[model samples]
Target: MLSRIGLRSFRAVRNPVRCLTTKTTITDHTTGRVITLTDPNRPEIADYPNPKPELAQNKDPYAKYDDPQNRRNLNDPVNIDDDLYDMWSPDYYQFVSDKTALKHNAIFFSLVFGFGAIIWYFQLNPEKPAMPRSYPFGGLAKELGSGNAEDDEFYRVKPDTTAEQELGFLDGDKDISSAKESYIQQNADFIKA
Candidate 1:
């Protein structure tokens, strides 16, 4: 019975010892340093540095009644109308106000119309021929069509011949027919071989 009681107390002591053995790291804010603690019996507190004198002395430099620089002029303030009129003069501040208003108005109108123009441009039909409808494939299409007369796949695989017409190589239906004949004659070796 006594041995069992001794074992129970030993077990309790072992659990508390394990809990106390856990370690923690802490930082000291004052000196920008770190410290570690492992004791469970005492609470740990990290040391911090005190505020410096230069940082603590900062105060408002523009306080009206208490300002050191303006203290001498504080007692001489009897010209109320003159001071108020001077402060309220439209002529004194009109230049900056007018310039800013003009700038803002110009920016507002430019942005409004600029965005509308962009939206309109995007909304237009993409497939419709743009004003003068210039062709892009040019003589390559005409050459391919005439030279590959025996090979139908060449004409079918090539791009449109509209580019040659736009480039003035096909001034009329006659010119287009003649170009087709010329292409076949000039490239006979390449086409037949």
Candidate 2:
């Protein structure tokens, strides 16, 4: 039965206790209409019609394309020579400013790159010590030496010539030497006399 009558009337019937409410009244400026906001559920519209200005009947149809202030006209005489002396003109000033900006930027980058190169060179190419440095492992070599100056001299020298011939170890027939051969003899019978 409540569903058939609708929910809004059912709500008023169920709640008999009445509560006093307030209404706000405002006037529309453009249309000069009085508006009363009696219910919170209903939306209030503030929009009004904005009509365009009526154009002059006898005026040119292309007059809309003219500058807003109508300062420049098509019939006005222009001098070509006067443009050269127009130093304060926006276009001329912009070109000159752009050229100067480019020059300054180039100078700044060149100085930066030059300073960076100088710093890089000093960092990479460090000054050498007046006296040459001794071998780091020379102490170990000296301690293990058998007191042979010529043998120990190899470790102390800058470029060690520790090849076989330099150490008096010949190329052929290692068995001929008094010392034992370094390599094992795989086929002693196949050895050439």
Candidate 3:
């Protein structure tokens, strides 16, 4: 409490929080000095700033190509002079050609690999023994004589109905053969069972 008010009689503090803050004091052999300082790095505002005039009274010249208010039409064909031909170094064209050649080589290799994969899939798989296959109707598909789609539909035997489908049969939507097959199987005298 005694150290807080020992340095200064009064402080110009706008906030009550700062007024309560105690300044640190340093003591040396020569004499004790109490330093009261603000932040040294605080920036001063730049002098002679352009004052913004009112929207109605403002008069500024329109910047030609960059005026956003009235932009030049993009579709207009007006050729500007080639002032920036030397924008890049002389060797830049060679570097661009090298990059283009690399890109074309990469595309060509990718196409070669893609064509190789397609050829392997179509021609090579048939020669291999264990090619993947699904027999939906029990390899009976090969027994069809003509192998045409029309004859296969007519001649193909009906696949057995699953128990779950027969159990879940709600109404007339159930297969007409389900009841007939069940009746023949239950009457055991017809077959050699």
Candidate 4:
């Protein structure tokens, strides 16, 4: 260990360091004096053996294109009527807006009529009941008013034979038959919807 430490110290003392330094001299013309400065810590800048050549400036590109024969042909200007963009002409802008409105209205009405058709289709149940709903007839009618006891038995009502007929033409009509009563009892809930 003592010999190794001695060798390390000897190697450190034997090596010589190369320091990069620069010196510059400047003159102050006004004061008529000269100054010299040195930078010891700066690293030496690498210099290229061959530097890039400077590029020449380009001339005006438009100067070569001065011939009128080389120019593009211009289109003829459009001569539109004064009313074209106004409300009067056949090719007016309002026509576009009117067409768009018509298209939207058509779509809206089609959707509404389509939905109505669907609802009407659903309302007409294929499994029609045996008895008419209105007094003149019996299976299904708009049951909007308060119905009498003689009316067709629905989802909630119990069939009553003794109930009076309120309207004039319906007064002398006979009671519902046993077959009709049984059918009504069986399909009461199905018809209500």
Candidate 5:
């Protein structure tokens, strides 16, 4: 093991290619400054054999376009009102605003009238009671006025009956029979002939 280790070290020292490193050099033509790099991972700078040729500069690009044609004078009067920006005109804006307002008014009024009509229709065509509202104790005023058993009968509460008759009592009649007959007539289809 000792002889092997010494022989390997000797071979590594003798073989320079195995331990070789990369080197790059750069030189500035004008400043005469030189730069040297010894990093193996760094890229090399390529040098051209010939120098770059210089290009001529043009002072005047319109040198060939020297035509002496008729030109307008700078002091000539120009038309300021070209009518190109007609959208900014007051009359046009007013017309557009009026049209927009009219459309909005039409939609608003239509919605208002439509909702009003719907409400009116519901008011006119109400949901009728499934069973006609029949109060056993004819008038609340009579019962509320006196708790007497004598005033419980029909004739005893004359004032309430008269008031009820005046305010269009059931079927606009005096008795419950007439009201029943009227209800039967109105819903004749539901009852037998």
Candidate 6:
């Protein structure tokens, strides 16, 4: 003997969720009709009329020839006519040649002037005698066996004093005082007395 068993519940399961695979149909805004073709997955296929044979092989007005081998060769020499060269007069060549000669003459004159100026300058002031510059401050001190301060003091001279007084002043001679006193005395009579 076999026993029969019954299901406790018979609830139907919900359909499984699917992603959207088909795009929405596009429509013209003015005409308000579907502008795009219907889905291809449909059982009935729509027939598309073929385009005219003459219009099918129509070329673009802006399209250029597509032959890459017909490109210009840069290595080829330029073509010039002998008649074009003959059009120029002989005087034109002479003018260009004369202009070149003038430029050469100008350059030659400039070089000659520069050399003359250098020679004249050397002749006016020879290299041997450059006024015999006095020794520098401390240099003169070493030469004279004195301090730079003493050498500087010796060189400074008053306009009224004579060269003899200046020499005596530098030598530190006692005669300098007597000489100054006598000179002052000689000039004293001429001074509004």
CA lDDT of each candidate?
0.49, 0.47, 0.43, 0.43, 0.48, 0.42
Estimated TM-score per prediction?
A: 0.20, 0.16, 0.16, 0.18, 0.20, 0.19
**Cα deviation of 94 in candidate 5 (Å)?**
15
Candidate 4: pairs in clash: 131-138, 131-139, 132-138, 132-139, 133-138, 133-139
- Relative to the true structure, candidate 6 reaches a TM of 0.19
Residues 73-98, model 6: lDDT tens digits: 34422222322222231322324587
Candidate 2 positional error at 31, Å: 42
lDDT by residue for model 5 (10-69), tens: 765575222112246554443444545433344242232222221112113334322212
Per residue, candidate 3 scores C-alpha lDDT tens digits across 1-193 of: 5456643433313211221123332222122333332322221211222233222112243534343342333443322221222222122232458789899999999999999999887875554363233334533544755377667766565444453244443454356578767887898797775
Q: What value does the lDDT take at residue 40 in candidate 3?
A: 23
Please write out the lDDT profile of model 1 over residues 57-154, one tens digit for every residue.
13244645433542313444333233333323333432468789899999999999989899798885365364333434442445456455455555
Clashing pairs in 3: none
Clashes of each: 1, 0, 0, 6, 0, 0
Against the true structure, candidate 1 has what lDDT?
0.49
lDDT of 6 at 60: 43
The C-alpha RMSD in Å for every predicted model, in order, reads 22.8, 27.1, 25.5, 25.5, 25.6, 26.6
Say which prediction, candidate 2 or candidate 4, comes out ahead on TM-score: 4
The lDDT, on a scale of 0 to 1, for candidate 6 is 0.42
For model 4, residues 85-112, the per-residue Cα lDDT tens digits are 2222343132468789999999999999
Model 2 scores what on Cα lDDT? 0.47
Using alpha carbons, what is the TM-score of model 4? Answer: 0.18
Model 5: ten consecutive residues of lowest lDDT: 50-59
